[model samples]
Target: MFWSKKNGNKSQEFQEILKLRSELSFKGIQFDKALFQLLTPLFEENPLLFKDWKDLQNKVLQAVEEKTWTIQDEIEFIESYVNLWKIAKSDELHTQLTIKGNQQDIQIFPLITFGAIQNALQLGYNSMREHPLKIRIQLSQSTLQLEVSNRVNHYLQNQADNMQFEYWKNRLEYRYPEKHQLFVNSNSNIFKSTLILQIA
Candidate 1:
């Protein structure tokens, strides 16, 4: 009877041990996962991301020789580009893309949002599943808008960033000078940028 009782107690302790491991809790404080845990997800994701990366690169290369894009073309490029980031991050980063208007037969500057998105991902506040990085595109009869927002990462705040706003500024000035507006600011630990161009 004593032997059986001791065996049952050992089984209970083993179960508790497993519970503790799965919960990853100690003294009621949860532990952050080890960095190594990211490797599995990264490896699993790169194969698909490689294909996406190639496609994006090709698009960019083609654009260098022929710089022409319609609103719908840019829309498709952003969708694919953002999807690359989504897959590469493997849910380590959260992303949302919302488009609320139909395509129009209007020309738009291609790759306008790429730099902004790169900045958002690189300067992510947490780059964790709980945080959100959003890219929004809103098209109306008169205006086309692209906006990106993310929590500011304090750690990278001190580092120099080359967003090349000048390049975009020149492009916008040349294309839509008086017809476009550019807004960028990092206030209260939130970084946001929006470009609105008059298409009509």
Candidate 2:
């Protein structure tokens, strides 16, 4: 009985280690994808312009290792992709940002939040026509809300997009089982997603 109990504890510990490693790996991949999306266009257009890509990459990796990010970090991260969108889509893309409450040094899960931002950007780009792509972020004492919306053709609203959003929603739920809420809605001409995280 003693040996069985010991082995059971060991097995449980091993499983936990594996789960931690898997989550870390997923976080790394998500960050890399977001970085790639932000840098690929600049690299293609003028490689020399992003001579610091490797350095920026290292900074991002370090941030992931630390597992916490400040409000400035989050804003900078989102703006990177927004800048890329401006370069790639030009006149077709329009973005607005509104920040409220105190955000000076608030800490957040950069990997999870940024992953959702990347997903939203891709969805908007894929479905957007002449209408502007809109992103709104609100920071308050108790909640962080991110909303992304874009006008799309009625036919573009399909199951694949919902599945993609679901994937991110699931990740958020896993990361913050009791602290986050996600909502996605699509109508004949518009697709919108909102993610709200309760600050601890």
Candidate 3:
């Protein structure tokens, strides 16, 4: 009985070590992937522009070694990743942005919240001139809200774009614990997604 219990504990410990290693490996792969995805356009357009390619390579290695990101850290990480991609694409493409409405002091996972909304703005809207997408951030007494609204085509009957939004919603639950709420709605010619984070 003593040997069985000791072995069980050892097995549990070994499993935990494997789990941690697996998570680290997955994050390392994702970091590399996100960087490649961001930098590929730059390399394709002007290889010389990536003059500091070695610096980027070092950063990825460091990030992996540190196991650097928490659930909350992923927001800023993705935001920075996407922002670089946008800047790289700007040489040939013009991406316009309009920021309106009020900004608030959101205490919980600010980077993630900002990144989700930023990425959503790019992906959620079909066109800037015709069906413009609007994202607004506001704060109440104890709650912070991110509202994303976009005009859609009348012929499209389903909320096909919501699957992407749903991924962020799940991330919030995992990252924010019990402090976040997400509301999503679609109507004729419009789709709206709202994320509410309660101040802790």
Best by lDDT: 2
lDDT of 2 by residue, 1-200 (tens): 35788899997886565456546644653455554665676676777646555545555666653366887787775676566556555565576656666787678766556544555455555433456666678888778888777665454545235544455555565566689887777777666778899876
Summarize candidate 3's per-residue lDDT along 1-200 as a digit string, tens digits.
45788899997886565555444433443344444666676776766646545444444345432232432243344434444544554543223333333333334542434334443434454445555555555655576666766664455554535443344444455556588877767777667777777764
What TM-score would you give candidate 2 relative to the actual structure? 0.71
Misplaced by over 4 Å in model 1 are 1-48, 64-66, 158-163
Model 1 residue 53 CA deviation (Å) reads 1.9
Model 2: clashing residue pairs? none
- Model 2 residue 53 CA deviation (Å) reads 4.4
Per-residue CA lDDT of model 1 for 1-200, tens digit only, reads 35688899997886565444322211111111221243346645466555556566566545531255787777787777656556656657778778888787766556544546655655566365555888898888889888888887776652115423344444455556599898887766678888888888
Worst 10 residues of 1 by lDDT: 23-32
Worst 10 residues of 2 by lDDT: 159-168
For all predicted structures, in order, the TM-scores are 0.66, 0.71, 0.49
Q: Which pairs, if any, clash in model 3?
A: 75-112
Model 1 global lDDT (CA atoms, 0 to 1): 0.61
> Which prediction has more favorable lDDT, 1 or 3?
1
- What is the Cα-based lDDT of residue 165 in candidate 2? 47
